[model samples]
Each structure stands twice: as structure tokens, then as C-alpha cells.
Target: MVMVEYMDNVKLGMLDGFLTRNHQKSLKSLFSRNKSPNANDNGDDDPSSAALNSPKSIPQLSPFANSVVSRCSKILQVPTEELQHHFDTQLPESVKELLTYARNFLEFCSYQALHILSSHPDYLNDKEFRSLTFDMMLAWESPSVETKPQDKETTCSNQEVEDEDGWSIFYSSSTNMAVQVDDKKTVGPEAFARIAPVCAAVADIITVHNLYDALTSSSDHRLHFLVYDKYIRSLDKVIKASKNALASSIENLQLTEGEIVLDVDGTVPTQPVLQHIGMSLWPGRLTLTNSALYFESLGVGLYEKAVRYDLATDMKQVIKPELTGPLGARLFDKAIMYKSTSVAEPVYLEFPEFKGNSRRDYWLDICLEILRAHRFIRKNNLKETKKSEVLARAILGIIRYRAVREAFHFFSSHYKTLLAFNLAESLPGGDLILKTLSSRLLLLNSGAAQHDLSGSPHAKWQPKLSPVSLIALTQLGFMLQKDVHLDAEAIIVGDVCVGEINPLEMAVKQSVLDTGRAEAAQATVEQVKVDGIDTNVAIMKELLFPVIELASRVQVLASWDYPCKSTAFLMLSSYFILRGWIRYILPSIFVFVAVVMLQCRHFNKGKPLEPFRITPPHNRNAVEQLLTLQEAITQVEALLRSGNIILLKIRALMFAVLPQATDRIVLLLVFMAAVFACVPLKYITLLVFLEAFTREMPYRKESSDRWLRRIREWWIRIPAAPVQLIKPDDRKKKKSLDDRKKKKS
Candidate 1:
């Protein structure tokens, strides 16, 4: 955190520029809708956003609060009046003073309501449930016009200091207040995480902040009601379309039981999916299921037999974005390359877009999600319905991500992606989150765990059985696994209790905080990168100047550039090596470096690091650089080819490809082994040392040259093994393309 603050100083201008750009863009968008708007985010309106646009729609509690409360009532199955009465009666007087405190009330109602709704089979698919819950988030962002200002003034003017507990100390510091709320009444990440997960379909508590960050990234990393609403609405459409698609896939694609269709493309002739198998490209309909990828090649007027790409089972699957082009030349970066032990070769699924590869990226993300989810299942060894729960969670998260990407036309960056598995993989301390999730999953049923967690229940706090999310998905008609029979009396509570933080949630929060620091650190790193190869090399050289100077002296000694120094240095090194003091010399150098660092730290206490000074190397033009590169490449290629040929000859000798060569190599190896057996290692080392030491001596020069020449002649006489190249069956590919060209012609 301290380092992040320091890094922030390094990239303050960059962050400011970023926020300013997004802020202006957001303002412009909102201004087009509203006569006058807030400076922070461009709020959306289906209910709350709609109210924000019209001054007349403002009410006593504001449509935002009313919408939230109304949704809460439905979840609680209580009337709105009774809900408000409960809130008024149950909450603390100090907390209930402002609309901001209403978030706590909303959390209470929404969480409990979510717990109840999560059990309903149709809750995830229910359009009204999604609309209401997301509307609650939108409403949470910007409240009633009257209440918003009042709350803002109340927060700012409340200087009445009360540190009744050690809490008020947390509220102020260098500037009057330790922590202060911003004037802009936007929903915070914490609030989003707390409320968004009310519907398992909306968010998972573990990755809610990431989802929020993804949803809000374009609006200066502030949640906008518009983005949230569009995302939820898009998700609703996607879910419904997927359900509809199942009916059609049932006849053609024999989907595995509990396999929910995720997405399908290439149904239209104009936007056909191009599938490349060992170079052959075919247009086809590609369907992504909960478990695998199904490709049905378009043939004659009918689709050929569907090719299933297993994602659920472990077949050493590797899915990544790769370049694909006509004839498999890899000229275009618009394909998902899938390679697995199950498939004969890598399959390229190309989504042709004239511009950026959004289509490819989309497919890549969804496919990886299923891949990673199954991996998680495998890694954790989840069985039966537990597998279903994990799979369903992944399914919902992907749906949410799809909704956001398609609706907002914006992609969440690495740290803020919505896919749970992807987010976990990318986030720092993410393994801890996964571990916590594994523990959480163990509490899915039975009201109690049978496993001996160190022997007794009274000795340790046991986790409660709460699988509301799984229940929600099951109710939504996904039917992920047949093994899970929901207990009617199972405790319907959130993974997180009202006043307590779940271990998984805490892990997520920690990861989120670490991610913020990582982003800040990355920003500073980006700022410090010197442009151009010459400049960067110059900086590197300057940083390593001491090491370079030492190396130069050693080089001078080795080449005997100065006879006196060379003789003295050689004597000293040889004495050290012979005396077995070489080991201590490196340790001594390490100690010296450590002392220097500590001394520097002591001398420069409370000060910044001194900037290294360096002058860039002379710049070379393209032609000069190219000429140098060509010369280097020529030398390197010759060396590599020579090395490879020698390796091949050695391989041939080992495999007895040639009888004489193999017999000679075997004899030589046997002799060497006999010598090694007979001789001590010390004698061998001494002999090697003496040979290297005397190689350039005048008396031994002739003999050494004769031996080297003989060895070179012998090596030249040894023949390289015969090699053959295997070309894949690409005739079908050529034929396919040739036919297509002819048809076009």
C-alpha cells in the first residue's frame, strides 16, 4: 500500500489523463440524455436512470430506493410498507439518519431476499428477478434527487466527532476525517459486491468486484447504472436465446445430459465460421455447450456430422488465440486454436471480422472459462452435484461476461475480467480464494460436514451448509447434475452472513486490493520504460557499468593485452583455484555487494533513489541495423546448422544407424568409462586444467595444432544421419480452397 502510494506519485499525470478522458466521455454521453448531469458517471435509466433524466419522477424516497425496497419486498414476500416499518424499527438511530445508510438496509433485505430467491428454480431465468435486482444496483448508484443532495450535505456537515469506540479514529486523519465519502453518489465496489451477488445469475461474491470493475471500467472505473442495466438485460436475452437454441440442438447435436448451450455462431451464410483442420477450412455452425465445443460443418445443403471438442474431460487441452489464414499461412489474427490429445491436430476456428478480433476474443474467453472450470473440478476432485454447482457458477459468470461485452462493446482488462476462473487465475493471492472456495463447497449440503475436521464440532467452528447459488441455478432449469436433491429445510443464507465476512469473500477482497497495487505498480513501470532499443540498451549498460568494467579488466587479462597485469591476474586466479579458495571469493563478493547496498541505504535514509545518468548509444538507420542483423543471422545460422548436423551424427551413432560409427563410439565410451573407473576425479580435473593452461604455450602449440587438425579431419569424416521430412495430408485443404476459388470464379 505504501509502495502503491509512491508509485501513484510516479504516474499521477497518467491516471489523471485517463480519468479526464473517461469523465469527459461519460459526461458527453449523459448530457445527450440529461439536461444537466453529475460529473462522475453517465447514469442509465430503465427505472432509476429514467428517473434521473426526468425531474418530475422524483419521489419521497426516490424511485431508486423505492425500486430497491420494492424488489426487497418481493424477495421477502412482504409488503413495501411492512419492509420500511421493519427497517425503521430494526436499525440503529445513528445509522438511519441518511440515505447512504440505506445501503446497509438494502443489503439486509437484498441479501436475505437473494438467499430466498436463490432457492427458487426459475430465479436465474426469471426476467423480472434479474431486472429488479440489477435495477436495485442502478438505483443504489444514484438515488432520488432530493435525497442525494440531502445525504451529501449530511455527510459533509457532520463534524460532530464521536469516537465512542475506536471507530471514529478510522474516520479521520491528516485532513479532519480519516476516511471520507466522495460527493458523487455512485455505487462503490463494496456495495456492488454485497448487493450484486443477491442473484447468483448477477454475480458471485468471490468475483463481484471484478465484475463491477469490468462493468465500470469505461466510466472512469465507476459503476454506471446504464452499463449495469444493459449488461443484465443482455444477459437475460443471452440466457433466453440459449434456452431456445437447445430445442434445435437436441435433434442435430446429441448434447450430454445437463449440457446447457452457451453460444452458437456461423448460422448465417455471410458470417460463416471458418474451421481449419490440418489446413482444410470449412464453414460451419459452432456451438459452445457447458462442457464441449460442437462444430457442424456445412455440407451440400445439410450440416455434416458434428465434431465434438471435449472441454470437460482432461485430454491435455490447450486453447489459445492464434493466427489463421487461407492455406494455413497464419496471416490473420482472428482464430481460436484448439489443441488437445483428443484431437489429431490443432483446430483453428476463425471468426472473420474486417477490424479487430472481438469475435475471436469472445470465443477464446468463453471456451477458456469452460476449460478452466472443468480444470478446477478436476483439481478439486469435485463429484456429482458439486461438479454441477461449480459448472453452473461458471455458466452464469460467462453469461454475465457475454452480456457486458456484447451490450457495452467494452472488454474488461486483465485485473477486472468477469469470468470467475479467469479472474482467479489473474488475481494475486488467487490460490487462497480457490482454496477458500473449495472449503466453501464442502458445506453445500447435509446441514453438517461428516469429515473429521480435527475430530470434534465443539472444538472448532464449523462452516454452515449454504448452497443457495447452486440451488438458484438448479431452479433456473440448468439441471447441471442429477445427484443433488435440494433439502427443503436447508438453511437459506448467503455464503456471507449479515455481519460476518466469509473466508472466500475476504480472500477476494484481499486479491482485489493487491490487484489495485499491481495496476498502480504497472503504471509506474510503463512510465519508466525508455523508448527505442538503443536507449534501453544504453540504460541497461549504464546500470551494469561496474560489472562491465570488471569484465573488461578480465578480458584484458585473458587476451594478455598488458603482459604485466595479465601475468599478475593469471597468477592470482590460478593460486585461488589451486588452493580451493575460489568458492570463498564469490561469497566475499556477495558480502561486499550486500555491505555496499546497506551502506547506501544508511547514507541515503529518508531519501529517494538517485537517478542513474547515462547517454544513449548512437542511433543506427534501418539499412545499417538491417545489414548488421543480416551478418549476425548469417553467422548464427551457420553455427546452429553445424551444431544440429553434429547432433544428428551423434544420434545416428547412438542408434547404430551406421555400423562402423556405432562400433567406434561404443569402444570410445567403454574406454572412457574404464578410465573413469580407474582414475580419481581430482586427477581428471588436474589433467583437464593442465591441458587448458598449456594449450597456447609456445612449446605445446605445434602438438596442440596437430591434434586439433586431426580431430577436425576425423569429425569431417563422420557422416550425418539420413533424415526425412513428413508432410501432413493437406491435399484435401488444397482441394477445398481450389474448389472455392473455382466457384468464385
Candidate 2:
């Protein structure tokens, strides 16, 4: 008997449901119409696809009408015109379907509207109720957006006026627009009158399950478990079938084309064909089908579950609501029925590995394989003219892959939110249960600590993570470490630094120095020159440009996360500038100051100075050291050039790092001018300025001597000569030379 019942469930309704007379007319008109840009906007495109049409014509119209009628019958006790007014003049066919869907959904609420109508004894006898139901039917019947309200007014003639206290209501008036018949009464806006009832009706419908329980007074009259289970199984099968159908259709549509060739050169090729053009056809509808299947899975899953839970069971037999949905049914089974049977678990395949050479890798691999098969088909049949068409197919395949990835990503993000509704319904406590579920999900996502890093012995077993997973984990780490609670610096340092100094950390340090502080500014000139970090500065500068470009890209892809990108750019750029100023410009300025001060002191001490000479014991070595230091300083000076200065300023503007009190605009300007003057001439003028210029110039001879020392220092440092380091052999040779020089002396 059970087998027979199951077999009976496979009964097919004709394609008749799809081939309605109105649909046939619409289809005929669709083909007849030009569909050109200048096509007329008459009723040709639409032929009364209204939910208000004859209930018998549609596959599932009776349930929809019954639901609405049950709700309207109670509300209709109020005058017909007033009830009609609440519908807000004439509703569009789309809105009418929404009303119907809302009404059907109300049945899952436990038939609250039905009980309200049945309990109100006067509701049935009321003539206005009948008239209002008729008016509602008319509201549904008028199919086109082009259908005027004036025609509806004529159809539902309004003559009777009912008065009670200050309220005067007209019954189904010709122009059903809500108008004040009572001079003494105050009415809310017409828009409010129309929308408020729909909201209330929806709310009332949502509350039906509780109302049904109250009305029925039977705990056993809840929902059936098997019905929803069957529906869910069937729906899942339908989705899979749909997917398979689409895949098969796509495979079958492959087109073949013949090879063609063109030679630009005059010399003819010996080959039979110059080029083979291969292609495969793809339907645009496949993309639409994919989208529809995804949404259908979501919707049908919820609906089937609702129907399962709304089933009523007494001692001997199971009774079910006509409109129970999948979600409500699932809720009923888990919460009320509380069955503990071991059901056959539905099969869910594992998520495909997204980083590998296999077919299970990224969807891109699958798409490329499909394209290859398509190319083979075209080549084999010699129908290769459809190259562009094949290209479009490949492009569509890529787009479809992206769409699927995006859908999966969205599902991953909000899977809990959608599933939570069902889970919350199942559990006794709402929010508390949700919290527990959330905690569990977080733990699962965190995964196990003992996941195998080394290759596991089991051949069937895959790695716990892939390249995409690592990338995702890195992104997740970034998000988690962004706040003040986590050490963002440590995380960045650990990840970016694979072997040596962290590029990100080095960039950040450079930025901090660029901002300039007391310690940085006070460092000795030689110390600054020796510790000069041009390599880091250059790395940071180059890194910053990409970061800036990345930030702009981030703005396009996900604008909300853009501040992070901007900060990355600004930090690197600032570091580059800071290293330049402290290492190069500041050192030169210090040298200048030191020379000026020495000149001042010498002049003040005495005028008994011999003419400046760099010849022996009193001179050249100190000058050579100074010159060597100067050369290093000059290299930095050249780097801190005008073009770079302008680049930094422009970068600063583009990044929008507003200049504050500590930004040192004046210092930057001064350094730019100094670098421009001194860097090009090997810092020669800088050496002169340091040597001769002084505030106290009364002793002119001392100033001149200071100038000579500075000039000698500058020349010796940069002269073209071989500076040799002595190895063991060189040291022995140097000692012999020294001994010979001593003997000669």
C-alpha cells in the first residue's frame, strides 16, 4: 500500500499549467511584435496574467483565493466601500500576486483569519462582505497596468451609504477612492488607510499558528513530519535535476565551424590550411537558469519545511493544512512532534578543492575544460566559423563561474542568518539558542589544531588547507588584527617577513622617522650618515606606490575597506621621506653649522694664523675624513632631490594626509632648495658655505684658514684614486716599502 501511495505521488499534471490561453495569446503577440526600440506600448506584450483571473484557470489558484477570502470575509463586516478603500484603489497584478502569496502564507500562521471569520456570526450574513469579496475579485481580474481605475469604479457601483455615529461609509462606490462622507469625522491620509491594513493583515497572518492552536484547543493538531521530509527530498531532487538538465542542454548545443585562412604576405604557404577556427555554442538562458535554480533551492526548501510542520494529527489519522510551508513544518517536527527516529540522512558533497591541478580545483579549471571540449567538437566537424561565438561562450562560462563563486561566498557569509531562523524555531529559547549556535559555528570554523601539515599517509585524504584557504586565512587574520585589542604590528611583521627584516615594519619605521621627532633631529651628523637607511627608504617608496594603486582598486571592489589601503600607502610614503630628510639634508645642515661655529671660535681666540695649507702633520688627514663623510652625505643629498620632493608633495595630496602642526612644511621646503643647489655640484657650495661664512668676522685671517681646510676636505674625498684595503700579503709588502723609505731617510 505504501509503495502504491508513493508511486501515485508521481502523477504528472499536463504541460497544460504552462500553456494557458492567455499565455498562448501573449506568446503569439510576443512573436508578432517587432520588439524594436520604437515598438508601441499597447496591451500586446501582456494578456491578463493577473492572479485575480478565474481561479479554475491556474494550477494553484484555489488555495490562494480561499486564503484571501477567509481574511476578507472578517474584514468585510465594515462597509464595503471602506473595506475596498483599504486595498488602496486598484492594485497592480504584481501587487495582487503578492497579496495572494501573503494570504496563502497566512494559512501556515494556523488559520487565524479563518477562525476570526467563523467566530463572527454576523460576518456571513453581512451583504457588504459579499460585495467586498466581489470587489476584491474585480481588483485581481483587471490585468494590465494600463487598466484605469475609473473602469473599476463603474463595474463595482456604489449606492448604499451606511451611517453610525459620526461615520458615514459608502458601499463599493464607483470611484472606490476613499473620500470623507462624514463632515464631523477625522480621517487619516488615503495612503495610510491603504497600506496599514496590508501590514496588519500580514502581521495577523504571521500570527495564525498560535491563533490556530488557541482555536482548535488540541495539542495533537500540529504538523506531520513525513510530509515535509518528502517535500524537501522532492525539492532537492528537482534542483539537482534542473542543474543536470541545464548542463546537458549546454553540452548538446555545441556548434561546429570550418577552418578559414588569410595570407597577408605575397608568398603562398604550402600547408593545406593557414588557421583552424574552432567554436562551440552556448545559450544565454543557461546563466538565467543557473540563477533561477539557486533561488528556487532556497525558496522551495523553506516552503516545503513549512508545509511539513503545519500538518494536524489526531489519535487515528494525520490531518494537514493545505498551505503549510517547509520552514514551519521543520519547526513543528523539531519543537512539537519531537520524533527520534534515525532518518536516512541527505547526501551533501564536500566543497571542491579550489587550488589544485585536478578537476575539483577552482571552477575556472572546469570552465576551461568545457571550452576545450567545445573547441574539439567545432574542429572535428569543420564548422569553425563561430570563433567569436565560442569566445562569447568562454566569456559566459567565466562569468558563470564568478557568479557561482560570489553566490557561494554570500552563502558562506550569511548561511547562519538564514539557517538560524529554522534552528531558532526548533529550540525552546530564541536568542539564547542563537548564541549557542553562533559559538558552535565559530568553533567549527576555527578547526582542529592537529591538522596534518606533513603529507598524510592516507591517499584519499586531502590537505586541510589549500592556497585559497591560506589566502582566506590571511585575510581573516588581517580583519581580526585590525582592532586595538590585537597586535597588528606583530601580525604584519610575522607574515610579511619570510626571511629577513619585515618590509611592512621597515616601511612603518621610515614613516615614523619622516614625521620627525626630538631624538631623530638631535642625532649627530656622522651617526645619521652612517645609519642612513636608503635601501629601506627605496623599498618603502616602491612598496607605497603599489599600496596606493591597491587602495584605489579596493575603493572599486569594496569601498568600505578602503581606509586600510590608504593607511598602507601613507605610512610607506612618509617613511621614505623621513629617511631622506634625516640622513641627507639634516647632516649637511649640521656640517655647515659646525664649520661656521669653528670659524667663529678661531676668530675670537687670536689673529695669529698662518696661511691655510693641507700639506702635512697639521692638515690633510682630518680634511680627508671630512671629505669622505661629505661624499656619503652628498649621495644622500642627491637622493633628496627636487623631483622626489615634488613627488612626495603630490603623493601627500593624493593620499589626503592632512598636514598638521608636526608636519614640518618649512623644513621640507628648505631641504628641497638646499638639495637642488648642493647635490648636483657634489655638495661643493655647501662645503664653501660651511667654511667661510660666520657671524663674527673681525679676525678675517682665521676665517680664510677655516675656508682652506673645508676646500681641501671636499677635494680629497671625491678624487679619482684607488683606495686599497691591505690583506696579509699587502701588509707584508707595505711593511717592506715602509722599511726601505726609513733606510733612504
Candidate 3:
């Protein structure tokens, strides 16, 4: 029955819940009229695909909607009246009746205008195209006068700018023009986040805000056109170069079918890449593909057979930056350590540079992007072209990241990573975004079959033109996927919608919020990181002082140095045990802790927390501190050895190293087990408590000492278990191929 249930879920897919089934057709309807829809979008005879014929009975749009329509007219080279008429005609009656009618109409115009602009070779390069599109998004935010309210800060007037940086965001929106944007005009994070991810191959929604932060980091977080233009163009240059770079080592690397090469290193003599296995080191050529890493060592002035380290398969792989040196001394931090289940040991690739490991860092970032992309693919169990699409997306993202790195020389932070999938894996709510994206990928139809626009099975998705970036790349003469082909006219439009945040964008926003909170908490932690071990120990000791004091008091009573107190404690403890009141001890402790917390909160309401006061250990020099740590470790080792010796003696008795002792101990155990099984638990506990309580009494002290001494003597006489150590098997880790023919003699 369990197996049947498991198989059902497996068939449905682990992410079945994330597949946006029955997705409403609001934005889909608006984005329906691309320059060329996918074959699956609609049949040629479909009425919905035909040119719009305005019906004058439709109601007039609001002021905001009128402005959006007018701008669309300018971009399309059509009259405002005709554009507005076309928009009203395309509006489904069911959609026109909603409160969001004007917003939907605005989205309808914006989508068509953007689609037309997408065909132009320099659309992204055009300042007006960027500004007009940004205004469309702003108009979508405040679609009509009736929907307008507070949060005036969201408008263009209060653009995100810092005066201290001698720069401001864009000016207020014009009543005539969409947005009065120019060289001085600025944009906020939200605006950039919305616009950039549309070029999904360049910016991912999960990391779009981070990418914005990266671009505007030096500009006081105010996104100026200069920075935005530079970044986009740089990324553009990177994509163009990277697409052609795949051919550099196609035959030499021998990449498998469908594998796209990401990056390669170690071609230059002055900047040779060193491969280290154990204590041996040699210069090599390293290549990274979407699936694996290949390193070919230089032998006799030529590269040898490449050793492949698989990344596409799950192998609990660990890749990180580490230091390496001659003879394994680890004196330089210019290497990457790659370890996986497929390899017997970790392999280190060192990028030798004169000063820093910038070269190494680049290799690390690109390699990790490919590694993480595959992990995401394997985690979701994606298949075929969908899998190819994911790898292609990752490949493009890395190239763009490299472009920015090369142009700006800026390294992204943990919260501001440039890689999309890498950011998703690191961000808090990113799984939901990935789930939505993965489901959306499966929605793209790659067949010759056609259906009516309204009746198409995937009509709910609206746009089927993605892997848009790859399509863009292919158009520019670079080919990554031979098995998968997308519509030639596919243009990347992200998941942004008409006056509504899509689920994927919502997840991204939430994750970015969480990331900000995480960075804040980490900042607080950084502020409190004490350097000295003695200071840390002092803090811990202060925190646990009450528990330490209680244990000391219990020890004093058990010593019986004060007979009256010891007797009273013993009787009280026994009485509590007999009444079974000790069962409530843990609950009582919890209640006490809660009360203490409340009391502290009440008293500290208007005050900051009092500083923790501790008389730290005497100040010591660095050498003295090191000596203290070593001494502590030595004491712990001593305690472990003593414990092991005691266990070994018990092992000897169990194995009958001494027949008399074994028989005695075995009978003693049988008697204890029988007592536990047959006797009432309360009576047994009372008997044990009484025996220990009276052992330190004045009358029995002498005999107790004598008995303890005898017990010690007996323990010392017991033989310990013998131990043997065996050497590990030594085999050659890697062997060269042996030819079948014998050497000529």
C-alpha cells in the first residue's frame, strides 16, 4: 500500500503542488500579441489572433490609462486614438467589467509596445525604450486615479536617491510624457528589479535586486542610466564573446552531447594553472562544462589525457577555496579544492598570480555556478529539453556575471550574488521561485501542432517564447543546445504582470526581504565577535554560573563534612523520590526559567541590557594563550585514556580473561537484572539511595574507606583487553593504460 502511494506521488512529480495549474488568463491575454507567437499559441484561423476591430461601446479609460495608451502610440508610430481603440477592442468583456479594467488595458498596450521594441537590434540600448518601459511599470502600479492613495514615495517624485552622493533618481512623471527620464533621471531598486529580470538570461528575479544593488552600489543606490547602460552593454558583450568561446576546445575537451562549455583557463604560459594531486604538482589546462570539470596536465610540452570530475551527478561533492604549497605545506591561498565520491582524494587547481587570487576567484565562481545549476536540476528531476533549458540559462547567467566582473571589477557579496540559481539556493524563500520557474519551463510547447488561442491547453501561460536568452544567443551566432529548439521570435519577458505581482516575483521579493534581515542579524553578530579565547570562556562561565554553583553545593553536601546538613539533604531527597515529585522537576525548571525571563523583561523595559560582568582570566601573551589551549587539550586526552582503560578492563572481565572474576561479576549482573524485573521500582530506588546516603555517615566512615580501598585494589588487579593495530591497504590510486603488445627486446 505504501509502495503504491509512493509511486503515485513519484508519477505526479515531487513538485506537483508547485505547477501553477489552471493559471488565470489575465496577463496571458494582455501578452498574447507578440510579433510571432509560438506554433502552440494559436492556429492561424483563430479569431483572437486576428487584428483588433474596436467596438465604440467600450467605456473610456482613466487619466493614468490614457497616458499609457498615448506613450504606446509614440512607440508604435500610430495615432493615440487608434491605439486606444485597438486596446479597447482587444479587451475581453469579462476583463473590462473588473475594477482592474484600466490596469489590464494598460498592460495590454505595454506588452504590444515592448514586443515591437524587442525586434529592434538596439531596443535595450535605446534610452527612450528603457524610460518608456519603466513608466509603463509605474503606471501599472497606480493604474487609475480611483486606485491612488498614500505611499507617494513609490512615485517618480520620490525616486530612491541620496543627496550626499550628489545624484538623484529620475524626476516626477509628466502628464504628457510617460516619465521625464534622461541622463540625470534615476530609478529605484524595485523599478530595476521589475525591468531587468525580463531579460531572464541576464538577470534572474531571485537575484535581480541584488544585481541592482551591485550596479548602484557605488552610486549611492540610485540607479542612473549611465550605470544601467554600462552594465547591460557589458553583459551584452560578455554573451557575444562567450557564445563563440564554446568552440575553443570542442574536439580537445570531448564534451558529451548537449554539454555547453562555460569557461577554460591555463592557456597562457605566464598565467599557467597548476594541478596538485597529493604532493605532486604540474601545470595544466582546465575546462568547465555544464556537466563536469576536465583537467589535462602538461606532459612533454603537450597536454595529456583529461581527468573528468563529474558535477551533474549527486556525489556529496565539496568545492571550496583553499591554500596550497610545495610538498603540501599550504603556504599559498591561490587554489580550489574539488572533492567528490568519484575521486579518491581532493584535487587542487592553483591559478598562480603575482599578487592575489583574482584569477582563482573567477574560476571558482564559474565552476560553482555550473555545479549548483546541476544540483538544482537533479533535485527537481527535470528531463530532456527542460533540463537543457536550465543548463542553458545557467550558462548564460555565468557569462553575464563574468562580463560585469571584467567591466566593473566588482565582486558580489553573499546577499548580492549575480548567479540566479546560486542566489535561489542561498536565499530564504527561493525554492518557491524555482518551483514556479521549473513548472513554467515545462509549459513551453516545442511542437508543430497548433490550437486556437483561447482553446490552447497552455494558453494560461500566455508567453511560450522563453529560453529567450538562449534564443537571443543563437540569433547572435552562438549555439548551446542542439537537442532543444525555441521559437526564433521568442523575446524574454519576465513574470511581471498587470497591477498584480506573480507568485514567482512575490517569492523573490519575500526572499530578498529575508536576505536583508539575515544580513542585519549577521552584522550584529560581527559587531560582537570577541577575539580572545579567554574572553569567550569568561562569557560562557558567566552564563552557566548558577548551574555551577548548584553543582558545587550538592558536592559539599554529598562529602558529609557537615553531618547535619548532609542528613537533612539525604532525607529530603529520598522523601521527594518516594513521593515521585522528582518527575515534575523538569517542568518546574521550565516554569522557573519563564518567570525569570518575564521578570527581566519587566525591569528592563525602558533600559538597555546590563553588561555581562566577568573577572576574566589573567592577561597572557599570544604564546601563553597557545600553551593554555594545548594544556586543555592534553587534559581531555588524559581523561579519555582513563575512560578507555576502565572500559577495556570491563571488556576483559566479560570475555573471561579471569575466570573467578568473570563468574562473580556475571552472577552480580544476573542478581541486579532480576531485582529490576521483579522488585517494585520505588522500593529498589529507596534501597539504593539509603545505601549511598549512609556510606558517608560518621559510624560507617572507617569501614566505607576500607571497602573503597578494597574495591580499588580489586580494580587494579583486573586485566585489560588486548589491542591490535592493522596497517591500511596501500594501492596505487591512479594507473596509466597498459598496451596489449609487449615491449620489443
Indicate which candidate wins on TM-score: 3
The lDDT of model 3 is 0.65
lDDT per residue for candidate 2 within 1-745, as digits (tens), equals: 2322221111111111111122212212321213332222463432222212211222232433333433332232222222233332322233235434332222211122222222222232333333333333332333223332213332213343446631123212212212311211111222111211221111111112222222112213321111111222232233234335444433333211211110011111221101101121111111122101010111222211110110011112111112111322221111101111221221111111224212212322322223342433343332222222222222223322333223222121111112222222322343343343222222221221112234232212211211111112122121111121211111110111111222222332343234245334546443423222443344455547766786667444332234455456445544544444425767787898899999888886876545322222222355675786798889888888744655654555445454441255456678878988767443444444333332123345466667778866743433232235679988999899999999999
Off by over 4 Å in 3: 1-79, 82-111, 116-184, 313-318, 321-323, 331-333, 341-344, 353-362, 447-473, 483-494, 598-608, 691-695, 725-745
Error of 2 at 274 (Å): 21
In the range 684-742, model 3's lDDT, one tens digit per residue, is 88888877878878888899899999989988999999987644432222221122233
Lowest summed lDDT window (length 10), candidate 1: 13-22
Error of 3 at 293 (Å): 1.7
Superior candidate under TM-score, 1 versus 3: 3
Q: Rate residue 131 of model 2 by lDDT.
A: 34
- Reference-based lDDT, residue 490, model 1: 33
Cα lDDT computed for each candidate against the true fold: 0.67, 0.28, 0.65
User: How would you encode candidate 1's per-residue C-alpha lDDT over 1-745 as one tens digit per residue?
Assistant: 2332222222221112112221212211321333332332444323433323333321435556655665454334344554455556544454356655555455555665555555554344444554455555545555454544323221213333446641334222312221232425345676677677756777888778777766665456665433454466567677777779987897799987888888899999988999998768899999999889999999999999999999989899999999989997979999998999988889999999888888888888889989999999999999876777788888888888877777656576677778888888899998898888897787566321223335332232233444555666666666666765654333344464433466788888899889889999999898778755567868888888999999887666555456677567656766766776766978999999999999998999999876777877788898877886788789999999988998988887778777886787889999989989998655565567556655655567789889999988877777788887645557777788999999999
* Regions more than 4 Å wrong, model 2: 1-716, 719-745
**Cα lDDT of model 1 overall?**
0.67
Reference-based lDDT, residue 341, model 2: 22
Pairs that collide, model 1: 44-49, 44-226, 45-49, 45-50, 121-475, 121-476, 171-178, 172-177, 172-178, 173-178
